[model samples]
Target: MIRPSIPDRSDDPRVDVSLVVNGEKVMRPVSIRMLLSDFLRHELGLTGTHVGCEHGVCGCCTVHIDGKAGRSCLTLAVQANGAEIRTIESVAHQDGALHPIQQAFKECHALQCGFCTPGMVMNILARFEEEEKLDLSDSGIRDMLSGNLCRCTGYINIIAAVRRAAELLGRA
Candidate 1:
């Protein structure tokens, strides 16, 4: 059997991981067992990447890794070495303006308790990146949001927000 490729640290399970987070480079020692979600939340203090269910199925810990959507809860901190990560905190401009997706969500009233919003926004952003544009069709919207889960809003407003973001991005 192949073993994990993580390098061993002398007195602990820590490993060195260097990555770019929200346009800033960061290097930190992370335990082998640490989840990327926990590292983002506890170590880096980027709590915008929320963790609902530890399992990858929930998609609540979604983040952009190397320009693609990934489940931070399912990813190990060591596995993210040398990657570029974008959490919800990065969705806004440095001038404090909302991103198109965030603006759409706000305008469309897509959130209630706001727990699953970050993941939904990140996933939609990644989807726009992957698909280049959205058709805004019902089936297309459903397919785009296949992995994310929301307990409130029933996705009606969310779909509207996705469409509005597509329009704002010139991708509709």
Candidate 2:
């Protein structure tokens, strides 16, 4: 009996990717195997974007892809080509002040280990900014933040922080 050999799938050139990062446009050559989280943290030096699970199960690698929250670990850097990418670092005042969401997180002691805070804050901020009128009910808050996971704080303080942030932003 003869066995078939596996096919070769190499010899592909790297793709040229261009993306607007934190309001600035950048162009770079990237390999097809590069992950968006690795690109942001390694290539761009944006360490604020944390990578918890390489899989999409954990939300620690979440970032705003064109104003919508998504898992960076699962996204290819090539897919982000010609798109606006917003990490946790971008969610701050132009004057270098902390964004209301960040401020609220600090004020409410929403984080302990600080690993999941960035993704949580980014996800919440995206929703808070997109929706003109937000309802800050307990169930609503739980549903909105359902994507983000927090091992510390049991999420009570995080929920309170998001509520306070909504109030501070005048969206509640």
Candidate 3:
């Protein structure tokens, strides 16, 4: 027998929200039940922030919230009111150039299928920023990316890419 899925309750209490996304302030009215991932993808049109597992286990929906890495799927948009959000699309350089991490990912062929690349890159960027003195060790890279699962490339390329990015950033 097949089970039926429950409908999303989108007609709940409405709330006014204002937050910084990709360095720009966005103000709008949203339902309290709206997930931050949906707000970024559907409302803000930032599809780079992917949603792999809606329950936040996959880490594919990772984003920067107030300078820390967080799972947008698990966070409510209303909770992000008055906060700062940074998606994968904003990680590029001011001149529209790829960020060092992104560049390394491309050069090292870190991704296949590309579904999990955005979240991996975003988490790496956030962690790199926080741990300013981080040295990209093999085990360390694996540990850092433990939350993100990629079914392609066997993760060797991803690790190599992160190491290359760290070298470029002078962190390795």
Whole-model lDDT values for every prediction: 0.89, 0.87, 0.90
Q: Model 1: per-residue lDDT, tens digit, 1-172?
A: 2424334444666788999999999999888888899889878999899888778887889999999999999999999999999999999999999999999999999999998999999999898888855668988898889899998778999999999998898887
Clash list (residue pairs), candidate 3: none
- Itemize residue pairs with steric clashes in candidate 1: none
- Model 2, range 31-117, lDDT digits (tens) per residue? 787889888987899999988767876688999999899999999999999999999988888899999899999999999999999
lDDT, residue 58, model 3? 84
**TM-score of every candidate relative to the true structure:** 0.91, 0.90, 0.92
In terms of lDDT, the poorest run of 10 residues in model 1 is: 1-10
**What's model 1's lDDT at 28?**
92
- TM-score of structure candidate 2: 0.90
On lDDT, the leading prediction is: 3
Error of 2 at 152 (Å): 1.2
Flag regions of model 1 displaced more than 4 Å. Answer: 1-12
> What is the number of backbone collisions in each predicted candidate, taken in the order shown?
0, 0, 0
